[model samples]
Target: MAKVLYIKANPKQASNTFLISDSFIKAYKEKNPADQITTLDLYREGIDFLRERDLGDMGDPEKLEDRNHRVFKYAYQFLEGDKYVIAAPFWNLSFPAILKAYIDYICISSLTFKYTEEGPVGLLAGRKAIYITTRGGNYSSEKTRALDQGEPYLKTILGFLGITDFTVLSADCLDVIGVDKDEILRAAIREAENLAQKF
Candidate 1:
């Protein structure tokens, strides 16, 4: 059975992003009934930030399971999967701070990625990832290109971890006037279902 980790970054309890993610999860489960799915909420769940003590014991075998050991273990759990799906809204042209913080924990040396002579190679391989996002403005135009920092940064970070295959689906102009939010959301859910069929 395949294992999927769904990361939710929206802080609001009933935000649009959460709704979109839940719809995706539902569609995914309906298609792959035998798959295992895990949900991680970056804001409400709160990821442990690396402190000075956590960084001090990088390669020390004696302190493997010390105070900050759980962080690494949790990160391993985050990376130890066949696929990942991330849902977040466009915040200041990027993701929430907590999402980035959680990523920092998982991207540690000798854990999620490793340095090599050629370059830093990703430790996790053959895993696919999907990103779902909603934006407040119409970012599809070239004039609004600056509003798309979330996708590129996520692609870079996940690619660095060896999770190469990626798919991104986004709904833009949610907050724009004279636009039908319901239709856009319905379209996104339809796309999610299509992706799940092929996932």
Candidate 2:
């Protein structure tokens, strides 16, 4: 059975991003009944960002091997997951700062990635990731897709960790003027469910 880690960044149940994620989870569970699904609510978890104390741990050879250390806690958890689901809303052309903090916690050497003569090599190779998000503007087009830095930024980070199978399910133009919010969400929810079956 695969270990699925669902990372939720938004707190609102009615959020378009969360709704799509919920649909995907429901579908995924139905399709893969034996899979172990764990939900990490970032808002509720209250994960801390890197600080002075963490700085020293990152460089310590002892802490790298000691998984019990606080510095390796989140990174260890992240590495253990076989599949990942991240849900967040677009804010300031990116996701929430808490999500970035969570990434900071996991982007550790020997856990997520390591340096090599060739360059940094990611450890979480062959893992799969699904990102669910919503944007106010239409950022799906070739002309505007570059404006949405959240998806690409996340894909890049996860790729650095050896996850090449990255999928993004975004509900775009939800809050656009004269756009039908309900219709936009419904389509996204449908797409999310479809992807979960094959994900």
Candidate 3:
């Protein structure tokens, strides 16, 4: 059975982004009922917060520390998964810091990746990811010129780990003026459901 890692980043329980994410989860579960799903709520459940020891542990795997143990355990769990889903709200034109920290924990040296004379090699393979998000402002218009730090960063990081296939479903202008959030969300759910069928 495939193991799925579901990361949720919305702090507000009632937030539209969270609801959309939950919808995606429901659809994913329906499609792949046998797949194991692990949900990580970064805001409420707490992520592996960065610390000096966590970095130090990467250099020497032989040494065991409390923070290092948590980092290793989290990395193992991440590597064990076959699929990953990141559901987060676009915050301040970017993704949340908690997600960033979680990435830091997984992408450690001699763990999820390796450095060679040629280049960096991803230890984890045969994995795919899906990004589900909602933004307050429309990033479609050139006049808005809004930068989407969420998708780009996620793509880069996952690509670094050799996850090549991923899809993004975004509902922009969620809180912006004159934008109908309910309509956008319904459309996003339809799109998500379609993706679920293929997934």
Candidate 4:
């Protein structure tokens, strides 16, 4: 059975993004009962930013530290998964710092990708990713797309890792004044459910 790795970046218990992701996972599980699912909650299982020592260990595999081992483990888990799902809320035009740290740990050279004679090429193939994000403001419009670093940045990074196939489910204008927050969230949840069936 194919493995699905679900990465949770939203720490808040009541976060709309988390709720949407949960709905998707539930539907996915129901549709694909034989599939294996794994979750990595960034807040619960903390990830640190790469430091000098971490970089040094990455350069020389022989001189591995405890933290480096954990980082490598994360990288290995990422490679093992056939599909991925990232659930995060847009924060300050981007995602949370913990999610960034998690990304840093997984984007290992020679593991996720490698530099070739022409340029950097992704190593992992035949994998796909689904990104679920909730934005406080409406950032999906042409006028505001440039300001949306969260979704665009994720797409770029995952593509760098050879995961070119992606499905983005975004719930925007969540915190906009006078907006029907409940209705927007319900619609997003329904969309998530529909996508899960074919994901």
Candidate 5:
């Protein structure tokens, strides 16, 4: 069975972002019952920002190869995943700081990537990722897409790790005036269900 890592960046269960997550997870579990799924709620996880001790081996690639290192736990877990499902809300044109902090912990040398004569090469090739996000003001539009750094930043990071097969399921115009939030959420839920079948 493939390992599915589901990362939740939002805390509120009632939030539109988490509503999408709830739907996705439910459908994914039903469709891929044999798959091994691991859920990591970042807010409940209390993931800390990288501290000095966490980066003690930042300069040493050899040290990173030691999977037993306390700081390497995140990297190792990330590497073990065959697929990833990340759920977050668009905040201030980006995602939550906790999610960014989690990213820093996973992007370690000798685990997710390594430097070569040419440049750094990602090790986790062929892995796939699905980004699920909700935006209050319709960041998906061309007029405002550039303003949304949350999804793009996450995609770039995952791509850098050689996980190029990516999909995005977003719920937009959540808080915008006159927008039908319920209709948007229903459509997103339907999309999530459809995507889970092939995921």
Candidate 6:
């Protein structure tokens, strides 16, 4: 059975984004009851930001400290997962800073990826990732697509880690005026359920 690592990046309680993510997880569990699931809530965990000292110690094994060991442990957990699920809400055209910090911790050189003569190569190949996000505005349209940095950034980073096979499930237009919020959320939840079965 696959080991799924679920990362929750939303801090808001009773949020639509969190509710939708929960729906996806429930469906996934139903379909893959034997599979193991590990969850990491960035806000609740209060992950620290990556600092210069940490980066230096990361490369120097002799200088590793307790904090560096913690970071490496996080990276090890990332490598152990067969699949990843990141649930986040759009914030300032991207994701929360806590999520970014988590990304920094996991994307370690010579760990998640390495530089080759040709270029950088992802160590975790053949794994997949699923990104679940909610945005207030409709960024799918050409007029506003350029403003969407969250999904695209996520895709790029995951690709960098050799996780090219992935899916993005987004519930947009959440904050649009006159839009049917309940309808949009319900539709998104349905979509999440469907994806989970296949995931």
lDDT of each: 0.83, 0.92, 0.80, 0.89, 0.88, 0.89
Q: List the residue pairs that clash in candidate 3.
A: none
Candidate 2 off by > 4 Å = none
Write model 3 residue lDDT over 110-154, tens digit each, in one string. 667889998999877778999888888887567754477678888
Q: Model 2 scores what on Cα lDDT?
A: 0.92
Write one digit per residue (lDDT tens) for candidate 2, span 32-61.
Answer: 999999999998988788899899889998
TM-score of each: 0.92, 0.96, 0.91, 0.95, 0.94, 0.94
Ranking by lDDT: 2, 4, 6, 5, 1, 3
Q: Clashes per prediction?
A: 0, 0, 0, 0, 0, 0
Q: Better model by lDDT, 1 or 6?
A: 6
Q: Give the Å shift of residue 155 in candidate 5.
A: 1.3
List residue ranges in candidate 5 displaced over 4 A.
Answer: 60-68
Indicate whether candidate 5 or candidate 6 has the larger lDDT.
6
Give me the runs in candidate 1 sitting further than 4 Å from their true place. Answer: 62-68
How do the residues 82-188 of candidate 6 rate in per-residue lDDT, one tens digit apiece? Answer: 99999999999998888989998889878899999999999989999999989999987889989988889989999999999889998999999999999999999
* lDDT digits (tens) for residues 94-117 of candidate 5: 998999999998998777998899
lDDT for model 5: 0.88
Candidate 2 Cα deviation (angstroms), residue 194: 0.5
**Model 4 clashes, total count:** 0
Best by lDDT: 2
Q: How close is candidate 5 to the true structure, as a TM-score?
A: 0.94
